[model samples]
Target: MASFPKSPFPKPPFDRQKPQDPPGRDADMDPRPDYGEASYKGSGRLADRKAIITGGDSGIGKAVALAFAREGADVLVSYYDEHEDARETCRLVEEAGRQAIAMPGDIKDPTHCRALAERAAEAFGRIDILVNNAAHQKTFESLEEISDAEWEVTFATNIHAMFYLTKAALPHMRAGASIINTTSVNADTPSPQLLAYATTKGAIQNFTGGLAQILAERDIRVNCVAPGPIWTPLIPSTMPMEKVKNFGAQVPMKRPGQPCELAPVYVMLASPESSYVSGATVAVTGGKPFI
Candidate 1:
């Protein structure tokens, strides 16, 4: 278990909060996510590699996209609807001197997921990295309160889409390729209100483990990133305003992490620096304890 300080970040602005989607956004977030693009620079660690990232429009996905671009990876940014954020990410990718392709669609659809894989392959001539970062969550006070529809939607967007995308992309991925999934801290110590969402995350953990073993033969690594509370649009959109106000207070870091803090971990895992690392789950939870 990791340790976290029990303090909250200073509130940014309540009026600035808005719901963009299930995964939410940095644009309407109160304090807005820090992408750390200015500090990060590429040294050709992933030069010529092609990477596809879902939910790359905002939050952690956006941060990862920027870092990958900085590391010399041509990025394919996939998102649900947030065209504006997608555009911003694309601009940042170009600013980093890496190619970025914006693809907007619902990952919940198998066809869309397959098409995204095909598009990525077409864009870069090969698929080297796939980051399953898109997810959906809605609060429920009790397990009984979770509707079948909600559960289905959560699984469809979170786990099923990962399966679909991987199936499509794996055919094109050769040796040394990587697949990273974005799990959550809830998978270990779940929040009751996010039962459905947590369940899908747990499934993703197991999926990562199993797929790692299966792909080991081909030298294709599979892993997961489990994040704790960080200041992102998801908190304001899904939690009550009062809860949102105190978000990340339970963590050892006292304040929620900026997205920039999470970016380098992705870079490390995707780079040859961590060539021996795979079938692992790296936690960036502001010192939140996890089992």
Candidate 2:
């Protein structure tokens, strides 16, 4: 019955700036994202569940990690060497009275992806949810500006790694388990500047739909979350400064979404309440139509 007021939309325009690299830090961003640190009240929606989330150190992944912990689920936070961010996420998870495991490695490597699943299985005894949320992206003016290596790296990190992790985790997952992948709005409306990244997201949607059917008999669910321009470190680190300043203006809401806004959808998809919901793409795109 208790509720809180929602944050107003169309956030004040951000100042132009650039972040460090492919995977940026939450602490370094100007006006850090609201990852539901002081909010996100939970009521045991995923009690005692065990989940593995890639890119769980910051951004949407971190938000989901915190939400899951608050909802009574133990979480394994997989990240790409962002030790401080990962530690902070783990601390928050612990504060919620849930266990958190921080695993730092590149999911781009299939071997490392399998190792992540193994580590989660070893620590938790079983895997109830798997969120493939880590990604790589860069902006280019023209097709010629995108190199062969960049294209391959993008696919490896975005889509290939999801395949590897899913394959490794399927064996450990039981009926009623959930697999949530982080796709992008670009899957439906591709961004020319992000050719490689968008292509991989498109692949993720197709993969989610196909996998859901294959696992139907086992009662495992497969779904994806498609986000629009979210106020995450990845925006400044990958896009041009001008683009970063006006990140979410193109969306109907005229403001970028915070990572926290996307966490509840993940909670629902991973909850038993969504047992009948699979092979679906849930879009959290700030009032933007996903179809």
Candidate 3:
């Protein structure tokens, strides 16, 4: 008999964890998230490619960086101030016998977003894949709890930064280059508690659709991945203890996804194998359908 993917992941209710700020450290989590360190083996799918992955310090971004490296790509890991996490990501990439650079900065700032692109081009000579995977998310009960400043920051970090980074990377990206954005299941099924974050995710899907058409003549592919509940540092740090305990129970799989599980999809998107796939949002929703 074949085993299911969800059989390996831990299920809810998880250990009750206190909520901290966003971009939490994976080291602090009770059950450390997996980034395919033991399981994934690349087959030169992205050989000699040069790529940039934002939020590469932890979560999905880290997994993507590690996978890209194993697939023969040199990666520039762009991240926020998570120096420790960022260093670990670079180490993983280098351990795979690839060049890795950790560039820490605030992606919410347009200037930093531009600088990130410039740094990737400087280190790699050309940009073959651009993964806009860095994001900011906060949960709120109602509109009243969502402050004006918080709302603006969410949009700035989530959507605006993607625009800034993509625009900066365009010149360096040639005809076969790929651009992958990280959207969410919330883009279709808005989580009541994650109002602002969900709204921006919706915007990302629309942006990707329009931009894909705009860049089609250039032959640059643009797409996104909409992941459901995934066990990442951001979860324990952003959600309340009650919510954290029951984090991914709602999904049909009844468990939060491990970052490693989503890495293959990202790997495919960044590879030339996905040349015909653009303007599409691939949903990794743990059995929860999104259309």
How does each model score on TM-score? 0.93, 0.96, 0.97
- Candidate 1 has an lDDT of 0.86
Clashes of each: 6, 0, 0
- Against the true structure, candidate 1 reaches a TM-score of 0.93
Candidate 3, residues 249-287: lDDT per residue as tens digits?
Answer: 998888889999899999999889898999999999989
lDDT, residue 289, model 1: 69
Clashing residue pairs for model 2: none
Clash-forming residue pairs, model 1: 3-287, 4-251, 4-252, 5-251, 5-252, 5-253
| lDDT score for candidate 3 against the true structure | 0.93
What local distance difference test score does each model get?
0.86, 0.93, 0.93
lDDT of 2 by residue, 75-175 (tens): 99999998999999999999999999999998988999999999999999999999999999999989999999999999999999999999999999999
lDDT of 1 by residue, 71-94 (tens): 899999999998898999999999
lDDT of 2 at 128: 100
Worst 10 residues of 2 by lDDT: 9-18
By TM-score, how accurate is candidate 3?
0.97
Q: Answer with 1 or 3, whichever has the higher lDDT.
A: 3
